[model samples]
Target: MTEGRVALITGASSGIGEATALELARRGFTVYGAARRVDRMARLTAHGVHVFEMDVTDDASMTSGVERILHEQGRIDVLVNNAGYGSYGALEDVPLEEARRQFEVNVFGLARLTQLVLPTMRAQGSGRVINVSSIGGKFYEPLGAWYHATKFAVEGLSDSLRLELRPFGIHVVVIEPGTIRTEWGGIAADSAVARSGGTAYARQAKRLAEVYELADRPSVGASPRVVALAIAKAATEARPRIRYAVPFGAKALLALRWLLTDRAFDWAIMRAYGPR
Candidate 1:
């Protein structure tokens, strides 16, 4: 049934979103890559991927994007909620407005878009919702409070949605990626320093920023293609797992999180990014 299925991927301008769009399109799906950065996706069209501007934080853009897909394709088989960012800063240092923006981009926009697509999916009697979470969803880090909160919310929301959609033949799957080579790390590192440096958390924020930069390096982070492959598998599988933690390390990291006592894990995270 996934053959020739229509797929819409958010945040397709760069990184994993872009990679997923390419992978899905290469697999013969009618792929629509959506992002506010319309120009960046111009090359995707060469591969037969439809490109459009979509600001996930905006309601009109999301609604109209879904409408366009339904109008053009008559059905939306896969929805990839991949548009998100890491807003890193000490909880006390990050402005409430920024925190709210994080949730708006990472959680509420995803929820609303799913709401818009469910009616069509129900009519078709089949669909897939693939949410791009992170290993951060399963663990903690310094200066990542707002970002982690949004990802944690995604984890919980996707889990509950999977149960609710099963009867309707709609499979909801979560993809938790480990550190991936992307602009995200640089952006997050900058945010951490900008928001927390010179404050009481400056020392820890600097260390967190270093970690982000280190992980962003191609040598350290896995390629976004790895996550894209995992997503394609989830989208096409007859019975995808509840979650796909990519590149092996993500699953092992999540397992360790569950295995260790919270306090012990906290110590570990501190030793890695915060003070011992």
Candidate 2:
């Protein structure tokens, strides 16, 4: 069943998306890597992965990408909604426009792609929708308010979809990854610094920026491959779990969040990020 199956992954140019594309290709799936940077995905072609340019915020792009896949492959077995970025800054420091843009890519774009792909998957009577969320969905961090809000939305959306789509044999799975060695930190830190340049929260935001920079290094974080493995498993496993929490600590954090008092958990998170 794995062989000849088609998988379309957004944000596939790098990070977990790129890793997942490679892993699925290795498992004999016809993989399509979609991102804004088409050139970056060119290397994926060497491993039998097709690369497509996609801007999740564009309606035409999302529609055309799904259409092309259906025309070429006739059926799409999996859809990985992985195209997203982090907009990190304190709530007041982040501009409304930037926050909306963040939701456009992280939330609306994901929803659009899912809408575009659902009919085909339903027609086939079987499919999988894997959403690459983050640990921020369950927990919070300083300067990550908007980013965490988007992921929390993803968590809620995926959960609701899972129940609604069960009758159609369409499985919705969420991959919640902890900090991984990726360009994500650099992007988030840059955003934080940019938004904090003349803001009151500049000092605390910069400190959080340092944390992001330090947390994303290879020594402190797990490899993108680790999250990729989880995505692949969610795609191919029989009766896949509704949620796959990766990098080990994710589930523990979720557990602690549920068991600990709200004040205690807030204290712990703040302690980990250092004094505000």
Candidate 3:
């Protein structure tokens, strides 16, 4: 039954991270949910999930979080790198500092956490590193240059890490969720409006913002639970797949992107988000 398996999930205060924590707990894992907002994790405690105040962007915070889990549980069987956000705006409009910060959180933070856990996982001779990426990793979108760049990095990083970790019995899995009903969409929309509003790209940026807003509407996108279940499967399955693109349609979109030429794919993306 995989009893006594310990898991550490970042960004577990909400959304996909929160859902995945509960899902793994239900499946008999000793789950520790980590995020900056410990207050948001109160609900998790009721479900037998341990909560840690972890800021993945900070070196000390991440190290301390991992140390706490290791001290309490003795070993971490699974590590979910899910702490990230979308800094949405045209590359020309988004400040270089903000763009760097986005990479710090989305790419460097994930890498830092993975580095901290790999030693322990290697020593134990078995573990799973589940990275929460996005379909944006495979395709591009207007006003999402920084966000997509980070995700694309995640995809490539995961691919290489998977190959390197194979002989050590550590599996690296990437969870590529499509548009999911979460606070993420609203946040991204807000960022786009703030960065590109009243500028040369204002119209298209707002158009893209509308699409992000729609993603957050009830029933408009898949629930976090769906991605959570897929993450749970990736974490527990003996031979987990390399990547999972959730909500079903995401797979089709990825295929379409591959089959179409660059200009054709770009036109389709613009059409989907362009003003009606």
Candidate 4:
């Protein structure tokens, strides 16, 4: 473990980000947890995690957060870009503004923060960038078009970055997680319900919302800790894998999708969404 090494994590107020911050702290990494909600992260301070307010969508905020961390720690050993949200609804029903906002947060925000951190990492000649993508990156769903698009972009971005940054001695890794029991499902479900109101796809959207809610129930999904462990491994392992597909089901899903024909995979996905 890199004792005293500094790690800056976004979206650290809850879910995988919160769990990852704790996990990294446990491994002796000096953790700076950034999110819009500072009160929610107050508990983390007790565990030695420094909390910072950050809005990834704002360039000044992103730059200042990195500058503050670099000023304090001198060098950032790891950067975890986990600050993103999902917008779930049918493609046609989702307004272009909302879709743009989704990309603003998921894609542009991530890219902005990465830009802020890269100079320091490049100068140091050693660092890790772990992007929390999703199985949705490899698979698609009716209501997740925009969300999946962002993850797919993340997949490509990380791949290209890994090669480009190799000469700088920096490693870019990705974590593709399956469904995990967290606020993610609730947020996604709520978005679906809101977007479904009065739309032609209302019924199907409602069903999708129910599916997310049920999947998020304690009995079905993996705990946030599962992803936390993956993040920790990516941040600390001597030679971290380029990508870590975790909670088991994600790997199986990716494999099954690859093995099946396009029509067959689409049929399977549709069936899983409930009888059409």
Candidate 3 lDDT, 22-133, residue by residue in tens:
9999999999999999999999999999997988789999999898888888899999999999888888999899999999999999999999999999999999999999
Q: Candidate 4: where are CA atoms >4 Å away?
A: 274-276
> TM-score, each model?
0.98, 0.97, 0.98, 0.97
Q: What's the CA error at residue 264 for candidate 4, in Å?
A: 0.5
Worst lDDT run of 10 residues, candidate 1, spans 267-276
Looking at candidate 3, the ten consecutive residues that score lowest on lDDT are 211-220
The CA lDDT at 15 in model 2 is 90
Alpha-carbon RMSD, candidate 2: 1.2
RMSD of each: 1.1, 1.2, 0.9, 1.1
lDDT string, candidate 1, 1-276, tens digits: 556799999999999999999999888899999999998987788889999999999999999999999999999999999999998888998889999999999999999999999999999999999999999888988888889999999999999999999999999999999989998999998999998888998998788888878886667799999999999999898988888898877878888899999999988888888742
Model 3, which residues run further than 4 Å from truth? none
lDDT of each: 0.92, 0.91, 0.92, 0.90
Q: Which lDDT tens digits does candidate 2 get at residues 84-164? A: 999888898888999999999999999999999999999999999999998889888878899999999999999999999
Error of 1 at 266 (Å): 0.9
Error of 3 at 162 (Å): 0.8
- Which pairs clash in model 1? none
